[model samples]
Target chain A: MSWLLTLLAPILGGFLYGIERKLTARMQSRKGPPILQPFFDLFKLADKRPMVVHSYHAFMGIIHFVAAWVALSVLFFGGDLLVAIFFHLLSTSLLIVAGYSVKSTYSRLGATRELIAIAALEPILILTAISFYLHTGSFEVSKILTAPTSIFTSVLGFLALLIALPGLLKKSPFDAAEAHQEIVGGVEIEFSGFFYDTVYAAKWLDMLFVFTLVFLFGGSSFVVGGALAVFAFFVVLLADNSTARVRYCDMVRLLYSLAFVLAGANIILGVVL
Target chain B: MKKTIHIPIGSQHISLLEPVRFSFECENETIIKVEADVGYVHRGVELACTTKFKFKQVGYVVARVCGLCAIVHSTCYTLGIEELMGIEVPKRASYLRLIANELDRIHSHLLCLSHTAENAGYEALFMRIMKDRELVMEVQEAMTGNRIQFDYVSIGGVNKDMNSELEGVIRNKLGLLHQKVAEIKELFDNNWSLSLKYKNVGVITKEMAYRSSLLGPIARASGVNFDVRNDSDYLPYSELGFKSITMEGGDIHSRNMVRLFELFESIRLIETALDGMPEGEIAAKVRGTPEGESYMRVEAPRGECFYYLKASKGQYLDRVRIKTPTFGSVPGMIEALKGSNYADVPAIIASFDPCLSCTAR
Candidate 1:
């Protein structure tokens, strides 16, 4: 079952993304593309000739995908939460490395922006893992899953995670890293063909990883977990649709001032109350 | 010595709709110097107007200068030719021309708003505004027989007349569009993230606007209070009770507000023109060749679109000079870009609503 889930994460993530596109389209009063559009896009990308600036840049794309898949499997197999988080961080770091290796200004700018974003977001993620440890007295996902409803006790931390979700998913209001209009695809500006396919699939895997983290908050009930994930997905979509992207400085300030404080308060409350 | 990094935005870029390029000299993220190229879309329309096309045919040729404001191009050219021939367009034809021009303004303004939102990364707002803009498009099609590139204006007068069926359609669609536009305005005014991207970003002060000789909403946003619609009698603008909208901030937010208020004002003008439209010949009789020189200006959606025609009692004109709003405002755009963060470049460009097609032509 764990192996099957690990294999199915990307497909499931793609379907969810399709739904997101459709929902966004409906909100905009237009008929969106079909649900299988992401798969079609992946298949089309796979058929193109691979091009790369350097061996390292090309290699990093594959490594990024592999790391993301590893992170997804770790989450599915109920491994250590910290290990899964670290692997997820590694995945993004590899993409950043790839971005920086290119001489293109857009790629470098995108890589720098991604680094800043991860700096703001990764701390909150660590605090989330810590909050989970405090709630369950363990770092293992299995232990957290079997524990009582973590959200009930760690509501503040959950809220913090919710605030950080857009950054994790690279949605609008926190999507300066991929500001399409300003930087023209940013980190992905240099990627094409099969290498582009890997980066794109890795994005799906990353979405799965973060939403799965949202699922863990529900603790012991699949229904609650699924419900929480759906709600968060809707909120993110709404935000992506309605708001504009903020500057990197503003993004860092928001994550630190709002999400960091909330997570820190949650940890204090867990220790005291 | 501090070394400056150079960043080129386009001849081809996602943010830009036309083929204009800007190279920015930057220290860290702040732009220190800016250079723009606005000649990519030139097709020698001015030369064609004199050598290839006659005065009547030139109206249609110049209309191709910019698709977004095709009616204004045709109308301006036709007005110049009509003045050269000493022809007086009927009051009813003027009213019809006003309706078409204002409809074009509504759609063009909506397109700019949607584009600005998209550049700011508000994809849903972009789509929503575009969807709403279709209502105005439908009205244009119903009245003029084409959504864009209508060629509704001719040398002596308008080419089409409004019927009762078209009138009903215009009123109904305009009513729906007005409500939709109002909702969008509310969102633009109150949305926090949007305000963050727009307010106080890419500011062009009144001094900067004046010094650069900026026109259109970019100037109006800076409290310049200059609109060709009010300044010229090319059409029946004053009789239609036209009021120019201006704001004080001179930032992206103010530009957007100026456009929104102008949209409302356009809707009102169209509705009034429709109500008070008189019955007369759509086109006047033309017999003699145009002999004199004439300069005509129209309040295009972007700004003042000026056309200077010099004819010498012949089929072809001696000269046809076009001064597009975007061309006049290029210096102002460069001035606005200097001292702003590179991240704000797309938003600032979109705010200016630069129509490179018109500029290059």
Candidate 2:
């Protein structure tokens, strides 16, 4: 189970990324590609000779991917839960900085939005974990498992996390970073073939990151965790399909303001109730 | 104190699916000047046509210029060619072509309306409009094999014949389309915010519309009282009794309303054309060459699609000059944006349903 969790980030991340494309296609009334489309896309990209626009991009992409990988591995191996979350958050921030390094206005604008969304949602995520710590007396996933999971405090924290998931999923209303409707591919616009391929893989891994966050509430039961994760994925998809994207400024105000209130409520509830 | 402000919107903007640069000069939020620099997605297909393909192959290539208005370009090209050859398409085939063109117009107009709603941050309305358009797209797929670039119209006649099964499918789908459009029209007509944003944002007066020689709904919105179908007596339009849809405002709101109203008129035309279906060969035989120049005009989704064909003794034409409706509306776009705000630029530009492919090609 431990080893499986360690591999879960990439495998699930890759899988979820593939699913996002399929979901997008379906929303467009197209018959999307098969489930393994992301892997095929990656393989196709890998076969192409790596052409670097900037020498630092190749390294930055690797670092970003590695950061996300380490974070996912920590979460999978039942390491410090807060540490895993922090690393995942760090991966996106580093990736944004890398995205900003490109002079392409498309990527720069996208990175700016990505940074905003991350800043907006990060506190809520941290607060959710903090609430869990307040109840369970530790910041580690192993301690979370051993603690009484039935506390009202944990559920409130879970709800706060759930509320933040859509922002993390980058679904409509919160899809400012990679606003395809406006900025094309955003930070990933100039990346083509292999460089884009790595970023694309990173994006999928990001989805898996959210899925794993949902699965954390599952508390080691494989069936419950897997089912809940899938349900959450579909829920996000439904939300994406139903809503037209909001503007970046509007999205920031909505997501951050809602998150602040929700996190504040969670903290108060965790302490009082 | 007046200060010149240059605001660049789109080469890769979020509001549009394709990229085109617009330089909007503003005093505060009010737009004073607008200049559009198109040709970001130009594939140079027109130049390729002159060098690569034969006369027969050019029609298909021209249709590929725009994914949205494929039928309009193909039909305009073929109509010009047929006139050059002095061969008239059969009555039923012409009517069927009209049906395809009108169906395309409905779907394209719906897409623009939906995009307007989307850009204005009205998602529920956008989704409702899109879902309704899906039914129309289904009808299109049933008629033409594909949805976007329909390879239906060919020189002299259409490529495929619509049998009773296809006709029945079209009728049933059109009936459903009527109901859906009615609901959508109600949604647009009743919305106050939509009215506030669109009503008089881009107003082109009657003289300006005619002076600019604008075609299609853009001219009609300005009370031009011009429709090629009614005036030119081209295709099945001559056979079918067509009514000119004219509006007085010539504003963005009126343009949108004219398009919406025209969709219903197109549905009516398709029904009339289908009911009066004739029995004849869909295609006409064209072997020999034509003599002089021929000028043909058709009502496209945007406006008048003008094709001037000069034929020689050779198999291929001497020269083909197509003045798409969008090219004519460029002046009108600049005119509309003169006193408008910067925020209204997207909505105003979108109101034209500008086909850069058609214009550049």
Candidate 3:
């Protein structure tokens, strides 16, 4: 089952993204692209001529995808939560390195912004893992899955994760790193052909990883986990549609002051009660 | 040992609709110096107006200068010829012209708003505004017999007349568009994240607007109070009770609010013109060739669209000069960009609503 899920995560993530595109289109009063559009785009990208700035940049793309898949598999097999989180972080850092390795200004700018975003978001993710450890008294995902609802006691921690989701997903109000209008495609500006496909698939895997974190809070009920993930997905879509992209500085200020405080409070409560 | 880095945007960029280029000198993410090149779309339409086309056919030639404001170009050029020939357009023609002009304004403003939203990463709002803008485009096609390059304005008057069926279509679509505009205005006013992106970003003061001689919405957003529609008598704007809209902040949000308010005002003007339209001939008879020089200015969707015509009472004119609003506002745009974050470059450029074709022509 874990092997099957490991193989299926990217395909399923693409389908979810396709559905998101469709929903966004309907909300905007237009008939959106077909649901299989992401797959079509990926295949089209695969057929293009491969271009790279350097050997390391090309290698890093493959490494990033592999690391993301490893992170997903760890979650699927119910391995240690901290290990999966660290692998996820590794995947992102590899992509940032790829971005920085390119001499293009857009790529450098995008890499810097991504670094800042990771700085803002990584702490909350670590805190989320800590809260889970506090709840089940174990770092193992399998143990947490068998435990009763963590939401009842760790509601504040869940809220913090929910607030951080947009930044993690790089949706609007927090999508400053890839602001297509400002820096063009930013980190992805220098990528093309098969190299781009790897980066694109890695994005899908990352989305799956974050939503899975949301699912972890459901604790023994698949229905609650699925519901929470769906709810968060819709909220992110609504936000992406209605708001403008905030500056990177404002984004950091918001995550630290609000989301960090929520997670810190939740951790303090778990220690006390 | 310099800390500033140069970032080039455009010539070919995803955010830019036209092929204009800008080179920004940045320290960290803050822009320290800005340089703009706006000659990419120049097709020498001014030269074509005087050489390739006769005085009577120059109206259609000038209309090709910019697709977004095609009607304003034709109208301004035709009005200039009318002034030279002393041809008096009928009341009904003026009213029809007014309606077409405002409809053009509605669609242009909506396009600018949609573009600004898209640049801000609000893709849904961009699509929504574009979907609604189709309502006005349909009305325009019905009245002018074309969607984009409508040869609606001729030397003496308008080419097509609005019928009762077209009138009904215009009214129904305008009503729907009014409600949608209201919703969009509310969204712009209340959405917190949108406010964060727009409220203090790319600020241009009233003093800067004056020094730059900014016209249209960019100027109006900065409290400049200079709209060609209110300041000139080239059209029946005074008769139609036109009131120019202005805002205080001169930021992206202020510019958007100014556009929204002007949209409502345009709808009201169109409705009034339709209700009070008199029955008369659409076109007046043209006599001799334009003998003397005449200068005409009309309020285009962007700002003042100026045309200077010098005729020698012959088939061809000696000169035809066009000074577009975007050209006038480029300095103001550069002023707004200085000291702003590099991330806000696209948003600030969109807010100024720079029409490159208009400028380059």
Note the residue pairs that clash in candidate 2: A182-B14, B215-B303, B216-B303, B216-B304
**Root-mean-square deviation of every model:** 1.2, 6.3, 1.2
Error of 2 at B3 (Å): 15
Worst lDDT run of 10 residues, candidate 3 chain B, spans: B153-162
Every candidate's DockQ is: 0.86, 0.12, 0.81
* lDDT, candidate 2, A109-162, per-residue tens: 678778878887888878877776777778887766656542344665666666
Per-residue error at B33 for model 1, in Å?
Answer: 1.0
Query: C-alpha displacement of A28 in model 1, angstroms?
Result: 2.0
Give per-residue lDDT, candidate 1, residue A56: 89
User: Which candidate's DockQ is highest?
Assistant: 1
What are the lDDT scores of the predictions, listed in order?
A: 0.91, 0.76, 0.91
B141-228: candidate 1 lDDT, tens digit per residue: 8889999999898877888887898899889999998899999999999999999899999999999888988899999999999999
Candidate 2 C-alpha lDDT tens digits along B32-84:
87888776776776566656777788889888877888898889888877777
Clashing residue pairs, backbone N/CA/C < 3 A, model 3: none
lDDT of 3 by residue, A97-190 (tens): 9999988989999999999999999999999999999999998999989998798899999899988988988888888888888887678888
**Model 1 lDDT vs. the true structure?**
0.91
Task: Write the residue-wise lDDT of candidate 1 on A1-273 in tens digits.
Answer: 999999898899899888878888887777999998999999999999887789889889999999999999999999999999999999999999999998898998899899999999999999999999998999999988998888889989989998999999989999999999988778898888999998999999999999999999999987888899889998988888778999989999999999999999999999998
